[model samples]
Target: MCPTSPSASIFGINTVHRMSLQSALIGFLISRMLPTPLTPQQIIVVQTTAVATGTMPLAAGFVGILPALGLLSEERDGTPPIHLTWLSAVGWSCSVAFFGVFLSPPLRKQVIIEEQLAFPSGTATAQLISVLHKLPPPDTSIRSRRGYLHLDTEDDSAEPTGRSPSSPQPIDTETDADINEREFVQHEGWHALTYSFLASSIMTLIAYFFPILFSIPLFGNYLAKEWLWTFTPSLSYVGQGIIMGFPTAVSMNLGMLVGWAVLSPLSKSQGWAPGAVGDMTNGARGWILWTSLAIMCADSVVSLFPVVYEYFSDLYRAQILRRGDSSSKEDHEVETEDRLVPYTWVTAGLLISIFVGTILVWVVFGNEGIKPWATVLGFILGGMLSVLGVRALGETDLNPVSGLGKISQLFFAWIQPGNVVANIIAGGVAEAGAQQAGDLMQDLKTGHLCKASPRAQFLGQMIGSSVSILVTATAYSLYTRAYPIPGPSFPAPTAYVWLSLARLLRDGQLPEKSGVFMFAFAIVFGLVSASKTYAARRQSPIAKWIPSGVAFAIGFLNTPSFSLARLVGGIMDYVYRTRYARDGNDISLIVVASGFVLGEGVISVVSLVLRTFGVGVISCWGCGHGLCGGCPAV
Candidate 1:
């Protein structure tokens, strides 16, 4: 999973309940009428659950699985039975759990304690949770039972700390001093979130009806028509860009500049792709995707070399040297035993999940399933990659799971030789493992900051991940049935990225010298990526100028219009921080961005429902129904 963007966490939960008056009203009435509203501790559990459920079957998992199963394209099967997909999802979920639970615990001392690497999103979330709990209850209501929602009773002094009178109470000096400040921020943040959500929701509905409102071609019509270089008038990308940061948004735009403005025209002129320039599959789009994937894979693998060495070196000392010395254990190595997830639990969980996953793989894929030895190899590689992923997440707040999958695919291509089924399964195992492990580690970082128990968090993670298996599988089945995925509305670009790698390894289908060029460029970019990381760690001034290979790869995958919207959003972030924000900690920006993403996302879901019912879509006229045709269904 990527960093816990606003869309991924708080806003997503808020909007779902807010979308229906019945749900919202019921929640409201319950808060007011019930004996007690949610406590701060309960609120933390809710947030933790949201984070937990967001992992396991990520969007990438869905994207990769669809193409891997050969269900997204015209030449492949339409869809499979939900039972089959659900069972497969079960296996996938278990594989992720194996790494998340069994593999993640050992590294807690190194990743979270010693190195103290800033998992930025996790840190942000921890801060947000702290601020939220600090907000005072309503001034006047039925009675303030305990938490934020309920009315204040006449005697406010009754159980002031929500504790029994006999219990010792610690003074909340921080809360008392910051009450006014917290109140101001709370009210403003709520207004921003609410107003932006309403505005975006209304605008989205309007855009769907008007159609022309979806497109806003700031540049000339010719460029918009020819190269998809237009402004997409939507808050989704803008919100994503704000959370993703300006540097990345700029990097993606640079990729668009190279891929669309430079490479597309170059490929067309040179007859490299040998098809219409605009064709997604056979033309410049397909051609550029390979290069993007190559660069990203290279960058990801190269960046992990140092971390991998350190991880293994630590293991060698603990396993080999420590055995001889017995007293060589470092101070940082010791953690509170009671706070830790028990080793017995980890061992048992791993054994059970691994057994289940292995059995399911053989059953699901039949003859094409990887052999038992190959399955073991996949797990080993997956565990190795999870370490790299956790390290990357610690440092940069990005998990290169897609690259991890491609790496596994490449390895399997050589091992299994032309077995795409084995290739996808192995790759999926590694990708899911890395993703789950990294996400869990990020959450652990949050848990550590919040002083939450690791054992409890792990249990919560297990339950949430288990539930996610069904939820994600059901969602994938429903969405596939509801709409023609890999089509305009659900492009599944990452799925194509996965498929492209599989085909390349399977069929050796590469344009003349393109593969050679891509590989060569990948190596150079990989070096540049490593150098950028080094410089950033050293606080070198030149680090900011060095483009992120991952971001550029994202740009290569996305259209120019999408990149343009992200660029606009990044600029907005810069502007807002410079002008309106206090020390760039203003809560309004986060709430607004969250609202933008949630509102648009909720509307998209609504549109998907409409599509399922065979409601016709309106065509945009402004930019020829989305940059000279290619408008997604509304």
Candidate 2:
């Protein structure tokens, strides 16, 4: 649900926080607007719908890249038809819905049940929902006596039967004292979240005018100016770092050190990339992106292979040996089956989505569209790759949809060589599939914890997806019409990266000097990631020291300034743990982080709207001078 708010929006608002923020906003609105408060089941439905709806719009971002780059036919107004854009969004929604319904179901048991991979975002959102609806309204007693209201009915069945390590364990019973304690905790949590949110929002607004406040040159002016090694005051990155954990942050900084300090300079000095240092087309940034992408790909492949092998092995046993469906199932299995999405529903949805999605692709893309067979192949590959995405999200709480999309691009390039439109569509389908599948799995995880019916959640997903078709389409069209994407106002950095990869695949323009480095680094990172996964599973101590490949690749992908800010966040987390943590739990830290992310994100959307209206911030402070980037004075 981390919809790209604006170019000015603060970074680091993660998926969990975004979803929670949206859910909170919607839930609050419903409570205030409705004549009566919703039941717990109704609340669950609302939250799930928000999540599903938010998850679907990512496809708009992916497809928006094409039109932004002038790949699509433009009307006389120099914009794609709004109707056509809406249709494209519908096509994307169909593709995403297919994977969410089809691919995710088959693997839920492996990822969420047997392995118990921590979909941390899901767990957090579920916790937030619980807190929000845990108690009745304060005025309920007064209103009930007047015969105007009834007490909120508690749904005892919603209690989780089992707890995953990532989620808080529910108490068996609540005494008066327990209830009081819970209320106190909730009060404190909400207080911290509210204050932190306001603080971050104020800081973001201030930084917009005094840009130097956003970027401090901590590593001396030479490094800051030359290599972009500056620290930032933005709480968003710090919050993100806190959420990702200290070790991962450290790993990311190490990657930044290697990429910016070592490889970038080395490549530039050797004339491998003679363009401007930061230029995405022919600069050090572009040069290193390949190696970074390779590392991510290698890590993804290495981490996924064992899981894929096991999945197929289990499938073989289940289908061939009849071992999957034991007559005497465990209690959990029995409970799960009662609420699980029925196979008949999945089969029907899958077939219909496949047909509709294929035709939509052909129609939307016009003459250079992907063939139906190729589109279906893309869906198959997307389904296969979604396992990789889902596993990543489950384990690390990061979904590398861009990396997944690039992999699809490479494959389509080989099969349907040199067709840029075909390549983008294929990659976009794959990206949407992976994204939607991962999102659905996470929602399912949340539902599992909440003990909400799977059927209800799935239905919520469909409704939300329908909503997404309209919302994403409108937003994409309006944004494209308003601003020049890939330009200063929007940048659309991820879209640029996607376009770059697509063109590279189309033209076969490998940076020769970086080829050996990419290959070698990919292998090394792959081994490191695979080894870490193996060691972690075996409870080996060495896993603690191993750098996360995904984080490392992210370091390479992002600027040094962002990495430094994250390092600051990691330090803050360590300090908090050492000084103030209770029972080794980071409940307060989570609250504060979520607040920071949500605050900046919400304000940034406001900023975007203001900027669009030509209502700009004034440079009233001396810090507005162009020492740091993005200064209004510049």
Candidate 3:
């Protein structure tokens, strides 16, 4: 049977149908007024391009570009030299052409399930449905069939079972037949306008202003350094949460922080030889090639262990452990077992893609002169380090660039003067990893919601990612051309090279410094803390240590302001999770939080649109043109 549509019920409600139609129309109109509405396909295309071009944060280019053009004052000492005219014309033209060709074909695709996918939880759409229907609170019981609370029913069997209960029974068709007929003629003009305006306004204001408020004291500096000077399309963490869901968004941010702020800086400090560092950072063509071969070897060896175990388990289950004819309950269990098969396939596909992608990269960028043996060794070492790094630091949410920076600084300390290239490549790889992981999560979400084939979703993602590669390449080229931030002046590159050189001089290979060791130690500490907190009460000694450890790490890595910001975020997270999360009627709270995230995206998009049109909302402090003098004309 086909999956039920969320809007079907609304159509059954005469009043709701009328209201929805009106709202959609009004939304359509308002969207036209603000900026051209890009369809989902168009958005996909744009996103791909943005990511490829390293313009994932769209604001980064504009921020830098504007300052260079004397439109906005230089906020920092180092601004990339960007050729605006060329970048703008090329980027916009490509974006327009790609969208026109690709999105137009799928413009009419109906949104059967338009809500953002939620993982480990359900989609936001499910949450909205539960809220609107006033479903019962979620039951924590493991065996309950309904994962969430359901309305009280007289039947005992209908009570919470904890696994997701069978899809809620379909509503009777006849119940709303008469109402639907009577409401076919009703108009909902004002209601539509109100909702659309409300959605847009609420989203816009929150996204734009809330971050500014949150960044007031400590976060202010980091925010300024990372976002203010450049067009970072994915700058707003909240927006990421809303669109991609919280976990994915948070993970991406974590990766970025680790790569950019933590790993890169440390690598540069170690100062491996300039030549070695250069090779590592500047494409590390040799290293990547060797790494791929090493991975293949390791993968081959590891496959045997899992394959043998699976083979034995299957044999035992089918032979000695086999029972008599399976009953209905056993049959049901067998059917449910199939659910896990899809996840396995998805994982396998991802690994294959990674291998293929690495090969392609190596072929395109590798050095011909590097011997296969050295490359292989480098690859093995890099892979080993990556694994260890992940184990020690936890899977970084920071950009891969930072991670690469760390690796280059440490291992290729002998390869000097290429720290800048290393940092950029590292950052790019980190970002790509984030995008890949996020894409997978999103695919999983869609699969869960629609029961769409995982294979299908994976295929779609592959297609989507292919498009992204083109977009990324184009965007990067244009951005580099327009806002050319010289490598020498870029803070990240300078710091990275400096540190990497130092480490090399001091310890030969990147010294396993106290900081690196400490980082690994922190991972163990985090694991222990998590276990203790879960086992003990909320206020247990272990729980106390968790926060202190986190604080210490923050202090070690960041400035006072950053530490302060984290503290504030922690307090807010605590309050929301404890207080708001518990309230049965607090659905609006999630929306509010989501609003903040959505607001960030909207503001970013809007700011970009304005800039594209030569309108500057932000201006220099002392440009003497009254309010109008310095600001870019709208």
By TM-score, who's the top model here?
Answer: 1
Error of 3 at 214 (Å): 9.7
Candidate 2 TM-score to native: 0.79
lDDT of 1 by residue, 1-634 (tens): 0111212321121121111211111222234345886543344444555556666546226655544455324333222312246566555555455555566676675677655556665665555445545532211222122111222234456443232234334445345334543565445655666777788788776665555566555576666555656666677667766766677778888887888888877887788877765565668877788788888888787777666676677678668876798886455433488978888877887777667766666666665456766776777788777778887777656676766777888898999886665676678776766777777676666666656677777777667676777776666666666654554345556767776677678778776557876987698888888898777656577876788787788788766766777787788888888887655445556567777876786776665566568764465455453432234422
lDDT of each prediction vs. the true structure? 0.61, 0.64, 0.29
Models, CA RMSD each: 9.5, 8.9, 14.6
TM-score of every candidate: 0.81, 0.79, 0.42
Model 2: CA > 4 A from native: 1-43, 59-181, 215-226, 323-344, 391-403, 477-484, 487-493, 541-545, 620-634
Best by lDDT: 2
Q: Which pairs of residues clash in candidate 1, taking residues 3 or more apart in a chain or in different chains? A: 143-151, 143-152, 144-151, 144-152
lDDT of 3 at 253: 38
Candidate 2 residue pairs in backbone clash? none
Candidate number with the higher lDDT (2 or 3): 2
* Candidate 3 segments exceeding 4 Å error: 1-360, 368-439, 442-446, 470-545, 548-585, 605-619, 622-634
Model 1 global lDDT (CA atoms, 0 to 1): 0.61
